[model samples]
Target: MNDFELLFDPIREHYRTTFSRIERLVNRRKNYSIDDAYINLSIVESKELSSKEENFHSDANYTTFEEIYGTKRPIEIEQLFNDNRERLLVLGRAGIGKTTFCQYIVCQWASGKLFQQFKCILWIRFRFLNDTRYPKKSNNEQYTLTEVVENECFSNKLTDDGLAVLQFILGEVRQAVSNSLPTILILLDGYDELSVCEHLQNLIDSLMKSPYQILTSRPYNTDDLKYDAQMEIIGFTNDNIEKYVNNFFTSNEPQKSKQLLTFLESKPSIYGIGHIPITLELICSTYGEENKQHAITSGTTITITTVYSKIIEWLCRRYLEKFCNCDKRHLNLKDRSEIIEDCSEILDVIGSIAFKAMEKSSLILDKTLVEKELRKVSPKRPSELRKKLLNIGVVKSLTAGDDSTNVEAAKDYYFIHLSFQEFFAARYLVNVLQNPKRKCYTKAINFIQYEKYNQRFLLVFTFTSGLLSGNDSLSCLETFWKAMTSEPLDLIGPRHIQLIIRCLEEAGSDHRIPQRSLWIEHISKWVECAANDTRDHKPLQTDSLAPN
Candidate 1:
């Protein structure tokens, strides 16, 4: 056998076995069509790939905001067309129905309603431009924006001679409309994902005067500019949330639905999530299944953490099974320990690199982090790396944001969704902790309900230098811990271990073994060791600890 086959043989076998076992556990017998799987995977693939010629959002199934939320931004969109000479810019958070709204306008034009005056409609997502820098190699499986646009626009070459191509397309559109036949309407979705800065802003500026452009972004501008009309796409309001809940939970009495609605109402963050139809779909799907058993189970609260966990769980159970099965049978990593280790290695690679979670949820640290963290246990990259991570459904390329204009800012990449960060942090904590006692799970449960920052878990590691064994592991944990301890939780810098300790101490009055007590002795021990081992350094958790 060829060397590549020889190497793939063993790893592939192990993966298959591991995946099989996982599938058995989940009882997944039915097979999914390749097209169906690719359709969803493509949505994720599109966001993960940062390319110039890609239109990742083109085939993305989107629902109208008015249909889904019953709130129309069409009037506002139309007003811009009527009054403004400049293009219309619609900016909002992910899942805020940006594409859906654009589609709605297109449909309106087709039916001779809202855009009846417009002669033609052309819709393209800004996601295509993300890949302008990275051309696809023949062997590369990852889809880029370029490939997407080529397929969607029904052309091999992008309209890429800069403004020349755009001008050509615009001419065709304009010609169609100017015949008094209709106004040409062009929709550019996910303008935020378009990373080519020089082209993006300038193209936008030019399009503004073009009389038929509509663009959407997450939140309003970071840069100042004038648009003919700018409309903010807030998520569904409480009424819609309530209606969604009521409609889904037909079996549940109105009272229960009302209670759940009240619960949803109390949290405004849900609005941020509900802006995306997929987020709404996930929430409604989970709620529909769970509500039949129990109305608003404590876990059912639509916190970002809960939503992400469910998705990750689904991915692990559904897709990872095949890889896990292969690992078990071929790699001979039979026990849970081996499985966990293998899993950790996979996560390590993914966590190291800048990856996007599916659904534009979060960006993961790139493979570089893996290189940094597991230099000794080096991973084969490009294909092997992609397969392992994608198998687990943990990491994907978030739509590439523009490399920062500033030198310093350009170095870091971001996950499409912030919630992925929280998920990554939480998973790492669970995996690294030396002990897997049920108490940690209980503590996690309690932490979600009672603890504000999950201090006990944070402090336990903070005080114990050896909590994570291995130099690399310890260094990784310590870096995160130090970053955490340096900043207040509210400020979003690092986890403030000191604050956790302080909170723990304050809880002592209940006659309960204060959570702080658990870590103080351990921390004191570490401090004593540090003093002996290195006289130059002051004790940790000292008053001198600078606030992050």
Candidate 2:
């Protein structure tokens, strides 16, 4: 009869028994219903991130993707909503498990183990709202909070009567001063990716005014959207990393887990980068590849780039196994390379889609777009390859359509993570550049160099640099470096600083760099630039690098 019961029952029933993917082998993927494998990464209270004064400058100096932007003390995920801390914002870098953190909170709440103070918790993924499939209310009026819950969050679309109940409940939720009535908490996921003009401002404004809400996003401008409290998912510590590796490997393969930890221990840089969840997954999964360890260990160096590239290569080998009906692991190097070379077609199509989505600042694309992009590359109907590109687990489905029925149905897909999209985009650009005969090669090269230090494309540039450097294609990346520091009059902005920092990060411990960078190799130069400019007409701000 009550609103909370009406909403919570449907949500709990639909999601309480959700399935998880247990990645056992690089070649095969199996899905089963269980919920124990999530490795709880450290979600620490974010220190008040300094303004554009280049806070990442120090964090960037490390060779590994070292943890940054959080307090020394880590907080339990549940602690986020505890102690009257309602208006909370959770931030993390790309692929740092921000959504997983939110989902964990959801799982906990649904199990009646957390946020007991509220009658129900509403989880909203802004990514879904950005999807074209999700019904858009209208352009003229603000979208109703009721419509948002019914359309965006609810597992099953609400009936007319149910929507009436929610509309009434929301009215009380906003006005209630005490817990005499049923109270609900809101979890806003992907705020950074939210397209604010989606007539959803009313919903956002309502949530902003409420004391019972949590917003999660990739770290962006805190100054734009302040919260009562903020937390950052800084990825796993060593102990948790060990636990994840243990969980990933089966009981029958315990020694394999031990071997991975041992390998990571020996390579501190690789281990440090493993703090990231996706990188850790790639590291563990690819570890099973034939000669993967030898390749990782034998290299003069290895970085996240090495891991990402190997995993894609690994996916190619696995794909070949299905066709050849043989163990790809047993294949010789020459044969494997030849098969992987053949698989470049799949990569080209996937990368084109990824690049288009990135240009639109979108994280998800529907099947129509995929087919359209595929058609441009291949003359035939790229139906089979399209399915492979999507279902392959790297570019994952956003709208988890009935996989048992039609994966090709009206489905929305996203790269496994934003970082994955960036990797594919970068890889695609490299492919284009490597092929001088391609008509777009010059345009592609120019785009990478002169993206105006696009904050959204920072990872793209970093990955591009890493790919070029990792593959001995440094000619392009060095030019990119020159372009980054080529602000007129050497007046480097924070954007420029971040671009340089991230690209340089990809440059370090990157398995292929012949020499290690001190990282501060630019500090002396930066200081010289700073002092070079002192004209009163051009008074410099602390947040910017200036010159005479």
Candidate 3:
């Protein structure tokens, strides 16, 4: 047999097993399988990207280039990879399906539907690798590509014979590479999550030199990275969004699905945001639950903050139903009332943990840390609460241990999505501000004024401002305005001022609030500050503040 055939023969079974294992693991962790949740979207070729450019600024020409080369003629994901045989970088905004695209590629490859030219494929999650610690070694020591593959891929479920076959394949591939023949495909996912180091950079550089390699990252300044070609994962089109919603609800609950689509159709604002797959899921998941169904059809105004709030409550309700046997449909009126009260109490504790995790910049919470945080709120039954959180998909297992074992076997937990954590954090702060007896109002004010401008706290700031302005109570609006204006002019950056402007705009647009004069007054103060260029407030040259 030829080298490729000999290497592929024994490992084919292992590959199939790995594919099934990954499908199950991803479905379990996400609480939905890709086949069910994925929406096929168009890929836009980035004209500015070229392999010859040593330093490519991804965003420098983005606006002009996109206008020139609109997505009118888009390409398939497979075509993008096939055209760029050497190196490709995929970029997209958060919740735009960069990771999902990677999973889809793996699925296709495993099924022999795409990239048939590649004899071997390896997917590496940079976030997990970044968190993994390796024992110190001598300066001369280095890790090999074969070692990385064995540790990440072959370490799980492979028999001795399967492992031997993998080693033989790697050996042959290495020889082929020396002779300038391509044989492997490497996919590095989540480049932004990786903390850069010389070691990691060297590895990336080596991999980029390979004939087949792909990397995915969120939109950022990419002048430091090297790639042969680049593509952007554009979010769903209106037609695709409708199709996805139909598919999501067709087999499960057709009536509810129609109601959701009708709701989105009526509200153009909500439908605009639904173009993003993650946001669409949030909308569907919230509207699917019986308690939150009213959120869409009840004529209550829905902003991003309100949608997130409903989603948080829905998640908490799911947790309670799983752990406390409190499914509302099966409970009597009194029992339902009690269950809601219990869920409210439990939600406060989970929100506290989420707030602490956000403050620490730690997205993944270890079991010990979760227990400690839970103990702060409920001294007893922290373990039970943790299990419930996991069951409801509020917090997912970061490390997949034996599924046959208890979920407590997981070493770490993280909020299913970063947006959820931010929502809970905002909830915690809102509670603090609304409590008249609490002295944490100043703390909340300081966070919004100082820390919110940081990228890490951007979501927290957005949610906080939305919640504060969305409230009809004059007291809430007064407090938000006061805190925003009280910051010294020198301390407020352009971004901070922009956020304040946004909050004022939201308050003015909120029809429930009768007092537009108060919002106008605060808006005037900030406008004056900008007019005078006070506090070194230079006009922001970007279109980041354009109305969405």
Candidate 4:
């Protein structure tokens, strides 16, 4: 191998070996490879992604893009990397396919389908960058580009020879910086995910000097980085959503895809989240499991929370089939929910893990944390329980190796995606934490119900509120909702409204009918809170927000 081939062979090999194994986030039963399911995403040139009309008004109103911002120049997908743009940014909300789009670019480039001008493309997920703790060498205050590149290529952490090979890659970047003839493309994804660190900040600043780079982040999370061009990934359009449904069903058996589209159309709120690719995939999988789609679409208005809860039910039913060799076919979701209750012991343990991770605002979980929680649920045989949960694919373990290794490739565990983490956390919040049976529930409850809400737990609280009105009678959340509403008008801020409204949105507006007294109290408190800035009224009694 000559100089260039020798330098990039590892990245090429790493992509080849691992890319196919990469599952679409929350894809059920390895249903489709990304290649078969991947849609070529279109981008509109705009600075704003969030909707102005959406406020604490309602939760069912998924964000609609409305802004005064204008698109300066639009570039087609084909010409995205063909020109000489030094820096570009792709922004979207959670689950809007930012990471998937980055992966698609890597796949295309690896196959010689795009970005041929660049000699090497380095795709580094900021989560990994945050997970990695680079030792503070006296000589090096920041992480080296070569080391970062080698570590995140999804290969075994290179201990020794990785430096020289990737230094050659860096050498090309160095030339491009001076000569202004860019030869490398660095794709830094999820900038918002990286934890606070001085070394990582320095490293990020260093890497941003690349002559050509593409950064992806949730909207407004790109404060630290600069870009020449900014594009928003709006995810699937109505037509694109239709296209995804067609791609999901290969057999076209029983016309399941057609049913899913019709179901989505009837429920436009559900249709809004269908724009998010991962949620769309789960909706399709859950709907395809049985013909009882009508029971849901025909019955009452289902919210996003209802969809996710049904997916969990689907998981339990599938677990019975795959693990226990029990097959109960064509049963309605209500009947199938008994399976979830049957599996509650295991689900509780997993949900606890999810809650703890989310409480810390982290996706990565330490191995010790996993074992400790596992022991609580099944002390007699934690190992067996661990195996079952891993097999079920909720929590995953990273490859175990030396902590000092480049990838820091130790036995760290993480959820399949951030949203699942939040959902399961929400489940635990309603079922266990909020339930009064547990003696120390008061101590646990105070942290979540603090005066100024922890911004991180907003989604957790939304899901928590949604789960309250779900099929299971979480009558305890009646008190939970009252406690949320009973706060002084001064304590009821924008986030509080967001939390409650989103909860109402997810649970369906019809949910408030039975709890009319509580809803009336909540609306009354909110109306008072929104009107007054009460220094005259005492500030709320708030405990310090802590992470698990």
Largest lDDT belongs to which candidate?
2
- The C-alpha local distance difference test score for the whole of candidate 4 amounts to 0.64
lDDT of 2 by residue, 94-138 (tens): 666777766667777778877777777777777766535444555
- TM-score of each model, paired residue for residue: 0.47, 0.83, 0.73, 0.79
How far residue 43's Cα lies from its native spot in candidate 2, in Å, is: 1.8
Error of 1 at 440 (Å): 27
For lDDT, candidate 1 versus 4, the one ahead is 4
lDDT of 3: 0.61
What range of 10 consecutive residues in model 1 has the weakest lDDT sum?
37-46
Stretches of candidate 1 exceeding 4 Å from the true structure: 1-80, 84-86, 107-113, 131-152, 155-182, 197-209, 242-278, 288-296, 299-302, 320-343, 355-385, 393-548
lDDT of 4 by residue, 1-548 (tens): 66566556667676656664446545534644546556755566654433222233222223542221132244566677545667888776667788878877787777777787777788988766654344456775567777677667736766455565467557634554556433778888886566655666777777767678888876543555567777777667677888888877776564788877887888667777787787787787777665646534654666667777777776777667677677565334347467677778778888888887665656677666788888887788887787667656566776533453332223567777777788888777776655677864775566555632554555677777677775455456555565565444334354454555566666675454345455546556654754473333232322321111
Over 283-356, each residue of candidate 1 has an lDDT whose tens digit, in order, gives 55444443222312343234434454455444443344565555323333243244445466665544334222
**Clashing residue pair totals per candidate (backbone < 3 A):** 59, 4, 0, 0
Cα lDDT of all candidates, in order?
Answer: 0.42, 0.65, 0.61, 0.64
Order of models, best lDDT first: 2, 4, 3, 1
Candidate that would win on TM-score: 2
- Candidate number that wins on lDDT, 2 or 4: 2
